[model samples]
Target chain A: MNIRTIITGLLLLTALICPALAAKELSGQEILDKSQKLNEADSRAASMEMKLIDKDGEVSKREVRFWSKGEDKRLIKFLSPADVKGVGFLILNADSDDEMMYLYLPAFKKIRRISGSAKSGSFMGSDFSYDEIGSTGYNDDYKAERLDDENGQFKLKLSRKDKSDAEYEQLIMWVSQEAFVPTRVEMYKEKKRSGKAYLELRKVMTAEKITKTGKYWMPFSITMEDVKKGHKTVLTMSNVKVDDDVPDDYFTQRYLQR
Target chain B: MKRDKPILCLCLLLSLGLILSLAAPTLAAASINGEIKLDERAYADGSSNQISWNRAEFKLKVASELSGQAAGYAELKLRTADGPDVSSLADLASKSKVSAYSLELREAYIDIFGFPLSNLDIRAGKQRIAWGTADKLNPTDNLNPYDFTDFLDFGEKIPTNAMKLTGYFDNTTLTLASLPVFTPAAMPSTFDSSINGYINAYLPAGMTLVSSESQLTLPNATLGNSMYALKLARTIWGQDISISYFKGYDSVPNLSNLTLTAVSATQMASALTMTYPEIQVLGYDLAGSFNDIGYWLEVASFTPDQADQTVISPAGTTTTEVGQYTKYTVGWDYTFTYDIYVNQQWMHGFFDERGSTLSDFLITRIEKKVMDDDVLLALNWLAEYNNGVVGNMFGPKVSFYPADATEIELGGFNITGAAGSTLSTWANLDQVYLRFKYSF
Candidate 1:
């Protein structure tokens, strides 16, 4: 071969190899972990508004202020609706075996530690369960498998690592390619028949709004719906501040009573 | 308490709230909220349906936060209740014109989040200081006295004037509180007759009752009558374990002395004096969950002085010594499949039922929510055993949420037991009630 012909062949070969390197696929767990890292912060403070809509189209609204520090500490206090105002919750080491929760009832002026199945129950009659509220990410609780990439989104199927410790048996997630965060999630309940296990669709959570803040992208508004029951809950966050000063004592019972 | 004292206190608090509102510009942060509720009740027996309560209440709460270190909260209640039912439209119009409404200051307190120490907080004012991990029926929660004006509302406590200090550390907390004076708890209207029977059981034979008249002497407002409490709590293995001590007088009065005189050969005049005796309690509680079942255990050892009554009678003089006693409660709660919730508690004492006559009670509740949690149905049961007598009470309620921050409930309470038993005394109180509450 002549020098010009050989150079042309090399150019073509380099072009083929570069695309292959660029198209290297990522494992499901890697995607989940990267997504988790993208969503994490040293601290977070936000004002959250919740609207619950029943099948009859009746809507109930609530407002709250929330603060979280590190990975294990979080506090929430109600801000509106006189009956529930001053109610607060403190959470520590959530979504783990050592999780602890304390609830303060302003009406009773009592602070009570909560445990057991209460975490799996509905949160303040909303569609979100306490478990869902406390879950920071799915990487630790689920075994993820890459399903496919469609419509510029990475699809994943996550199955519970341990059924006894998880509320949902399986979840289907659609992550945004640009944001590395979940845009939609479908929760499935597990059922067993003749020693065989299966899953059924139970609830769907969709991110309605996404905003970029300080090189990170987050869901600013989300909606969780129970399809079978036709019940929907929309949660919207505003005034979100992250990676700022949050006192460790803010997660204690003293701050909860405030 | 003087009938007008509550009103005067309400006026003073209102002025404070008004000033707080007018000065909101430089007060850092302030908020005001309130609620209104109406309740009505009727008896269940046929042909004699009598109204028990026609109460309307409005509660107002004001709160302020200064910078990031201090906060204050105050609540007031305005109520019109227990007046004669309107027999005609004219009665309804004229009854409101009279001074039948009463005002009360429920709670007022200021919190110093971190001063003098970064981990200590001081709360001072007239407020409810509740200390316990159990659900309601807590033996260690004694800072405030009970409020039984509405018999169906169990575990309700009246706010007492007090000051509290709390010290916090890693996984531990210590609380100290003091009340300047003693306040007695309110009881059901029929409780006097019931107490008469209980005291008579301790009297000698042939001491028949002339008139059911009893007098209660209030504990003097003195430095010695001040109430105090302390609790030291720590978290161990995700469980809240606490040891507490309380020095005060029992909120419920007991028969301290009785007198008997022979009017005729067979007729006897009997008089009884009720007084609150001094008491000291040492309490321990463990609250945690095993698996998916939440459980709590609390135990208290009580030492009461003058528990036995001194009897001076024409027949003879009898003095009985009251001994030390212990009270305990064990409770467990779980939410089963389909969102059915069940809570059960077994307690060794009820109210002032102490000494050798202490009763053991089993209280249970089963509840479920339906229609997207807009409706709730619950059944409450209580079983009591004292000596060999057994008593029971059942309460069932259905609550519906028709709007946000509003609730309507229909409920009933029923009791059954042998005559002269504690439960039987409340048998005549069986009734059905309807409540409407709205919060704004």
Candidate 2:
């Protein structure tokens, strides 16, 4: 063959090998790990507003303040809606095998323990389930596989390593490569995509490079749609602060009464 | 004397309000919020149909950053009802009488946190102290009195003048409270005429029932008559457990002295006296969850001081006796798919005079969201079985939220039971009610 023919063949080979090399560089599991790190911090505090909309476009609003330390403890207090103000919820991930939750209602003036079987139940009557909001990290519970790449975004399919431990059988995530954050996620009841719920993260905010950890991206707005029920919930977060020092007693049951 | 008590109470309440308002500006961060509720109920029997319009309330709260650990709160309610005297504007002046319904201080308390220790809190005021794990029927709950005039509103607890202290540990808490005043349950006056008629019909041959009066003997307002309570609560292995001790007077009065005076061949005057006896109670409660079901058990043993009951017979003979009792309750609740909740409870009363008796009840509540979460439709049914008598009350309500600050509720309650049963006494009192509330 002439030199021109050899050059054409080399060009074709390089074009095919470059994408394979890039694919091998980061597996889906590694991408998920990096995304989690970029999204979560050691401690966080935020004031959030939740808007619930029905199929007919009716809306109701709720306000809450949230605090979380590490990956295990979280506290949420209702701040608005006179009937439900002063209601609190506390969650503690004690060990890998178990989790503890408590609820405080102002009318009852008592703290009550919640059962683990409610993981699949709605969170505060919202479209999001308890497990969805209580999840610490996805890597520990799911086995990930790279699906495809489109428009500078990587798509991954995750299957629960143990089916009994999770509410959803499968989840598909579309992650943005630039910010290392998941832009959209679809949850399936079965292994296939017959019954699915959709979640979208919008209006992401990133911290400036003033902190030692540099810039970190967080979703300021999130929408969860229950396709079967034709219901949707939008959560808008404001006044968010990361790496703030949370009191050690904030996770206790007594704090719920405060 | 009876008519003057309410006026005196109102004057005292108004003076207290003025003082609190004058002192509010001196605090650090003060806020106020409350609701105005208007309720109208139309009874099927038309015996006690009424409309209450002036049910306004405001809660004032103040916190001081100077001490960084002190806060004060007070809630005042102003209420009035339109009586059945006026039907039109022509009778509005002379025929109509406007009276104050209730001017109540629901809560007036000062809370001091981090007192004496890092995790200790003390509250002294006229406040409500709710205890126990059961839903509405708590044998271990004795700190507050109840307003039984409206049986459907069992959740309302009357606040008492008290001093409370709570100490917190890692997973446990200890609470102690002293209630210096005795408050009795407010009973409905609907039973007065019925009880008088029954007593007259059962009288002996030589005696005819004249006017009968029932008097309540309340304990003297003294420090020795004050109530004291202690509770220890802890969480272990995901279960909440508590032990409680209470020394107080029974909120319910028992029939004691019966005297027949002014006796003649065809007429006799009857006087029945009711007394609240002091009692001591030891209680234990436990609550836990299994899967989606929640369960609780509350047990209380009561030892009351021997109370003498004197009965004067038509033959001019007198007899006396004494009485005592114990109570227990077990309850469970579960939520089904579609947000249907079911609660079941069993209560037993061991009376020294009447022996042991058991009562079973089940409450089913179903809620549906319409118009997003803005409108909610709730249906509640309470079925009770006591003393081989079955009774049920079904309430279906629809609440609409025009805005975040306003709620309108339309509801109806139907009560039914067999004759001679407890529920049958108010069988004709089924009502359709509408409530409009606005909060700020």
Candidate 3:
């Protein structure tokens, strides 16, 4: 009576707790998991390139190099035009501090700081803003909601965290279930009638040759439509070398302006 | 100076003559250009308030060649800001619905090309004539002296809404433009009661006149009541220089009778002796950018003078001699990279012998971009040294683009100085701003 009765009691207790635990529901945790997967699929550096061929066939090509540390920070440098030979930028996304932006101008032989308010401005007269190229922290700007599951991916409805965070009141992203990579994004920023943009991911390729990290698929090419400007921009990434023992000094203003 | 309203009316009528000539069933090259911008600013003045909106502006330009030697271009702009009201000015002063839109006549002109004139082209209508070789303060680029107050406002441009005629020869250009018969600045007391006192306090009292302290609103103050002027610019030996002159009268609305009587009866009659001058300013600008070094200088003079007498309880009479002022600035910009620039400007305001030395203004800034065009950084130091208005500002700014060219910026302005007296210690005020802009 002692062994049999004890076993039955233990079994009854386990069965009772299982349903309760399942009912507790970890919806937030599920969302984070999906986000991590999406980020992993976009972790490669080589898949992103530096040429913008507009729909009008106007091509602006440059040599762009980028380096990302873990999942939160990255540094990208533009190499072109004799005057901007040494300009570089450093971006950091730490948990405790506001994002930092540093710029190096060769002409002044000094580094000047740009304010966060100027982030949305055109970067070097290009259609893209400096903020456009930096990491888009889900926590800093948007409240993402999982809308539905379709074709092996989760669709999200993103509302701006603050009215001023974006020109668009809402954004929609389609993220893959296996990769967590966003394949498409739609922007609605203006008075509901105009200022809409569509970004479609054309191709995504996983990291190759760099064997230490095998769980990442980076975007190889993307097309952006600026309906208002009557133009389209295409970005292609190539020759990406990650974690190749790059020196910290290379991201300084001196390197950018050189 | 009194406005030759009759002559102005005639000139405006004559301007129509050129429009009639545009009727000859012509095929011209027309272009439509526009920019849609969305801007958001987060103020750091303790309230942590924010202002954000999107503005879509469209400009249409039509240029056509007439006969065998003439061409003309016309431009029209339509703009509207959509979003919630967070603009500091709107919060502090005016309030308008999102539907508030405006039509701006940016450019309208007729040009005579070739002709019997060698190396000469003639243009007429509301035009822009920039003739300075300097950076920020083009003393010689006197065709237009910008109104900082207006230019600093959101979605506004600084040009007299009028008619102009320009003749070009070789590297030299001679331009004569109508001043749109307007006042340089509006009087503060003319604002409606809906405008807060603090908001009205910052309006500059330039050439505009004040009529009464009773009527808290002004209705008939605009460019419709003014006259015209002339502008000239020339380039010599690789250097550019410009000069301009203007004369216009500003009538002090509500100054008709009642307030004058009340003032004449008060013991402050001496203060009432304040003579508001019809302002006339002569501006000169010079600028030259050679290699990586560019320099510019500008000087302006406000004619006539101003003064006042006030009673200080225990100190008897305090003679506050606030006179006319001369504003000048010199600046330089050096391009060290294909996309980076270092621009610095130094300025000084010299008051007439009758004006207060306590009201002078100065500024300096350094700007640059970094991080593969994803990050931009800047360090700025600005100081204004004078009694009741001396302060220094210094801080860093950071700009980030999370996607392509779309931007978001955060900036802090660290300022310290006497809140009231020039002799007092500095009190620091920090401003934090967030901006997002899209241009296509």
Per-residue error at A51 for model 2, in Å?
Answer: 3.1
Off by over 4 Å in 3: A1-258, B1-28, B48-99, B111-120, B129-131, B138-157, B183-228, B249-276, B289-291, B305-325, B336-340, B350-362, B387-389, B394-414, B420-431
Name the top DockQ candidate: 1
Worst 10 residues of 2 chain B by lDDT: B349-358
List of clashing residue pairs for candidate 1: none
Clash count, candidate 2 = 0
Query: Which one is best on TM-score?
Result: 1
Show how many residue pairs clash in every candidate, following the order shown: 0, 0, 76
DockQ of each: 0.73, 0.34, 0.01
Tens digits of lDDT, candidate 1, A1-258 = 899999999999999877445334777887888888987888888998989998888888988898988778889898776678889988888766777888899888888878668877888788988777635688878989999687778899998896447778899999887788899999999888999988878899998678887766888888999987899999999999888878887898878987
Candidate 2 structure lDDT: 0.71
Candidate 1, superposed: residue stretches over 4 Å from native: A1-24, A192-197, B1-21, B85-99, B198-208, B211-215
- Distance (Å) between predicted and true CA of B318, model 2? 9.0
RMSD (Å) per prediction: 3.8, 6.3, 21.9
The iRMS of the candidates, in order, is: 1.2, 2.8, 15.9
lDDT tens digits, residue span B199-306, model 1: 576455766666555678888999988989999999998888999999998888778878776776656667788988888989999998788788899988889887
lDDT of 2 at B353: 22
